[model samples]
Target: MSARLPENPAPLTQALDACRHRDPEGFHRLRQAVAPAMLATALHFVQDVRQSEDVVHDTLLLAWLNAGRFAADDLPPGSWLFTILGSRLHSQLEALAGRPPSAPRAVPTGLQGQALWTLAHGLEPRPPSASLGDRLTESLLARLAAPQLPRTPTGELVHPPLYDARLRRKMLTSRLAYQAKEGFKRRLGRPLEEWAFRRWLAQRSVGQWLEAQGLPRRSVEAALGDRLDLEVNPGRLVRCMSYPDAFPDRTERRKASNLFLWSGDWDLPHHSLADSSRTRFIQDLWTHRLEPSRSETFRRLEQQREQGRPLRSHHKGMLLDSRERILEYLRLYLLYMENMACFGFDKHEGKDRLGVTIDRHGRIIKTNKGLHRLAMAQVLGLSEITVRVRSVHRQWWQRHAGDAKGRDALERVAQALPECVPA
Candidate 1:
């Protein structure tokens, strides 16, 4: 109770610093001090006391989880806390308004497009093989295609690998002997035999095998994490391999299929791997029509508009595929090109790729990820690009508040703190 209460950011940051070290008493004291202000801010937005309390509670929990990430030294405690409080409250508003929470918008820099295509199409491990039945059936067909197999009525190999019991028996016997020699065992401590091992392997997935082998799951996840990174529909099927070096490190045989040609211009100024929505504000500003060398058609349109005449919508904008474009009034001038990487993909933290979230009315709510890339695509006259969608049906707000420790302590803090009036 005698702890120096934070009247401003310095004392507040000190209290947060103490909380980072697992000082429960220090955290509680600070929570008690800040709760009133947070609640007052929440009440200003959502007048209901119950909803205000919920907002304050969630804010405190976020402060707890991400306290280390907050830059207490540079910002005053009130400013920092209020920012988080405002963000959380805004997300709540979005949810109530039937919109998904806002994700960070980024402009697609040249670096982002180049990096994704290069990395995505870069050397990577192949996906694991098909299921036991499919693998065996395919292998059998290949074997039957060999010269030794009997011919069908039409002179083709009989049922191509026609379910040879002798071959099957030989393979099983060989596998059993190898397992016996290697001293592999079942979970029950019994020696692993061919039949049991085969059954177990068939039942277990590749992820499970990695866990058993003590391999980091990140090995495959890192390469195949974007399995659906380029697709539009959320339910679209993903093929983990198909491109060269698709799954470089692994020997698996899976490949991606049905990569839709969302854009015809492969070498455009920008290409998006995810989906994005376009707002009228962005469209009217012609953010995408921006280029170092202004095009004549756009210049004419600008002039026509300045003269109080309506400009036609059919004016040719930036060239879609060519890096070369002529500026208006200058016959030989080329526009300067700016190619920068905007986002990068990573396994642990969700990759920062170009994406767009759409609202129910088919409007672009926001660019979920790559703002830079979207601008480039727009400038290039590209209409459609692949991107991830954050639907209103899916809520990404912090729903639950506690970690390993129960919510009892946090609940007590909320209860003991006094409610402060809004400024």
Candidate 2:
């Protein structure tokens, strides 16, 4: 007799909860539900039915072992299962093919015959339909059945070449920056600075260059063309038509192009540029320099105004309307700086230093240090100076401020600072 299963409203959620609570039945149900999808995803990576199946089995075991760690709000059991399957399959594929598993190559329509011929020599099961899942299964089966294709001779599977993670991260960062800038431009009705936009383009260009060198033609086209919206046709034509003499030496050209495209400028003395510099520039651009501008912030505020609704107003008027609000803006700036520091901006100079000192014309009158302490006090919602000194800075400023408290302390501090007139 078929076993009866529990009828829960959200079986997946219930299974996850049960697994967290150490219920064997819930764990089994979750495993069974996710196994097929994991198998399918694994096959897509490994391209060998037996190995793919093995990978799925191993992945399921691992998932079950780690089931207690799974959160209901995180990915569903199927997706989590797939992640494990994909990672294991990648390792297997790397071993068998002697290279990393990259994005799948697009088989040409005419090459279907070749693929079918390849499968015929292997143990791939032919499914009734050519659905994506079926195709994946077929590919895996074919690879398993015929591990040694005559053309390959050594019985190795054809795999795409591996790229360093740094390249991938750089590419992704540039793409995100471009999208963010475009979104900002749309909202603000003003284009981002040309230099900034070009820098983004350059990083994308470097990624394309690496992909062109490493990826197969179809894979290269798919990755650069479809995802990044870059036209590889023009790049291909340029590569084909240009004579060796017209370009710098191969090594120089690659280095220059990588830097120029990724760094967004060819101004550096090409011969003198070091690999560290190139890497540093890419790292800096990726982390610190590629953020949405203040213009975006103001534009968003304006948009809210146009919609006949607005953000909360203080007694002075709109939150962004007065000079005091500049302090609030600077607080966000500090947060941005902190984010940059966390994301590999430590190497670059000036990134560590806070900008926007309160100045009259060109002469510096005030600094962010005092403002930050004040802002932190406000954020902590302190009302009394004695309370703030005790709780916030721990009486560090008591000797200077005397017994002053609250707004009076702030006023006294500001008055004490030198007020240099505008130049």
Scored by TM-score, the top model is 1
**lDDT per residue (tens digit) for residues 187-249 in model 1:** 332322233333333444442342233222222223234442332322221111112232233
Error of 1 at 235 (Å): 16
Query: What lDDT tens digits, residue by residue, belong to model 2 across residues 1-423?
Result: 112212232665666677666555665666545545444455555666666665554554445445666664765544444444444444355446544222222223322322322322333222212243343343334333432322121122321111122233444454466677667755652322233333323444443343223212222222233221111111011001111332346764444321211121211122211122322332232222123223344445446645765443221112343333333343334333322221212212221221112111212211121232222222222222110010011122233345564334434533432331211
> TM-score per candidate, in order?
0.30, 0.23
Candidate 1: worst-modelled 10 consecutive residues by lDDT: 332-341
Off by over 4 Å in 2: 1-9, 100-423
Model 2 C-alpha RMSD to native = 28.4
Every candidate's lDDT: 0.35, 0.34
What is residue 318's positional error in candidate 1, in angstroms?
Answer: 53
